[model samples]
Target: MFEFAWPWAFALLPLPWLIALIAGKQKHHSTLMLRIHALAHMGMTNTKVTPSRKWPHWLLAIVWALVVASAANPVFRGEPITLSEPGRDIMLAVDLSGSMREQDMAYQGRFVDRLSVVKAVLSEFISQRRGDQLGLILFADTAFLQTPLTRDVDTVAQMLEESQIGLVGRATAIGDALGLSVKRFNEKSQSNKVVILLTDGQNTAGNLKPEEALILAKDAGVKVYTVGVGADGRNQGGLFSMLGSSGAMLDESLLKTIAEQTGGQYFRATDTQSLANIYKELDALEPQAEQEQTFRPVDALFYLPLSGALLMLFLAALWRQLKQQAVVGDA
Candidate 1:
């Protein structure tokens, strides 16, 4: 893929030779003592002048021509890459109410809270989505955008994992979460816009209603997938159940309606394995489009050829000076 960007400059390569020829024919007069002729007169010693050491200058000129050619930006194009999986933009809306601390979901024969498992699984999920712009929204009594839509998935995940329950008070504002997600998505609507809403309770707080938020999402061409997490029915008082002190049930119908309104589906994750499976199923819902991109590395090949030419010029000049000094010494 090597190419000379300035092929027209080759025409000037022979111009130096013309200058050399003209220089050789230029008339010049020099005075010298002619003892053999017994001429004391200042006679004309003019003769056709030629370079005694022409090869150095010729090499120097040729090298300079090459340097000029290299400086014209000779380029080597590399192969292009096809990013088969086109990136998408996703916003994860998580519920961080007091109920999220319920330790009903079992993981490896032990019960863990909803948030613990969510963090563990989400960390892995975010890793798989490279090149995609991801965001985080945590909602409880009020919905707050923890991170804006960005390509930095690591930062988004870190912020999500660092979030604690009751950051905005202890109430589940499902509608506000969806509304905020819709607003964020509308800020920069991409080819594929999505919101993964995970909540363990119903909307008890926020200015907007669930139906109103769903309408906003539909209007903005945004898809909303709702996930209702926690075990179904009620759990009797156990040794370490956080919900043992109170009675509550997750609002599946509202979550289902939100998902249906925005061309998405509702997923019920009662346990860790089911939650993992639900996310795995979601992985297939949105297929990435193949994209092609071109990349050209801007390498500075000028230094290579320039350095070589400079070194040659230096050596030539030094040799000429040394030859002149040697001639003077011999005389």
Candidate 2:
């Protein structure tokens, strides 16, 4: 409803009039000084003000009222709107090593590369995450932050879909991925920080080691969920189980250690069905708040009265100038 933001400002409504009354007792003799609050005084500012030419006392009072009303901060408060903030921050670190080129995962009854399946699944996953800050990391020979933490899940999904296998290098860098995630999480975290690390091979490249990254994440209170993606029957031109999980066999033990130490879980996605289940589990992560928040929108209306006051002042000045010119002509 329409109201004054600061109702106490109305107390100043009589301030200008009080000043007028007090000044009425003063007596001064000066031929040059203007004796009233009129725009005419602007031309003879140095003159001592005295009881002289009749001023528009009523106009001045109306102007003062308008100015006082503007200062009171009139506003129209809108209805309260409930905001459903997700409140959680998530980082998805995907392996883009040469091994990810393996055609182990089946899509639409046809074999596709590991990265393709990841892009499809994760893009859908990213779309459902509303109000949560999501980030993307692509790792191969090393780790790289593809997208910083943001609420724009559509952009995050676009980045994920645009990724190509072996874009960085051909070797997996699990430690570098985890370490990079930790650094990002520390940079901007409001609530919980979660890392979903997906890889089809063991950590064979990178400066940092898996054990070292694990300690770093645990110390920073960063939770990690490790996903090992390679088919059990990796032979017959699939992916793993034949060449032993692209470049090297899946390091289940290291993945498990990292997850457990960081207070997370380890999931093996040998197929698309299992990966979907993993998504369900990830969805269970705690949000920033259990209850929604609400806030009222306000629109300031002070400008309305403020504009009127300025216009009245301008007109008064113009009127005083006109009267002064008429008097000079008459003289």
Against the true structure, candidate 2 has what lDDT? Answer: 0.83
Tell me how candidate 1 scores on lDDT. 0.77
lDDT by residue (1-331, candidate 2, tens digit) is: 8999998999998888788678755734332254343546555686543334655788878888898899999999999999877667889999988778788778879878878888888888888888888999999999999999999999999999888876888888999999999999888645588899999889899989999998899989999999998775544575343556552388989999998888899999867777888888888754445568899999999999989989998988888888878777776
Worst 10 residues of 1 by lDDT: 27-36
> How accurate locally is residue 263 in candidate 1, as Cα lDDT from 0 to 100?
92
Stretches of candidate 2 exceeding 4 Å from the true structure: 28-53, 188-190, 238-248, 285-288, 316-331
lDDT of 1 at 32: 28
- Best-performing candidate as measured by TM-score: 2
On lDDT, the leading prediction is: 2
| C-alpha RMSD between model 1 and the true structure | 5.2
Write down the TM-score of every candidate.
0.80, 0.84
lDDT of each: 0.77, 0.83
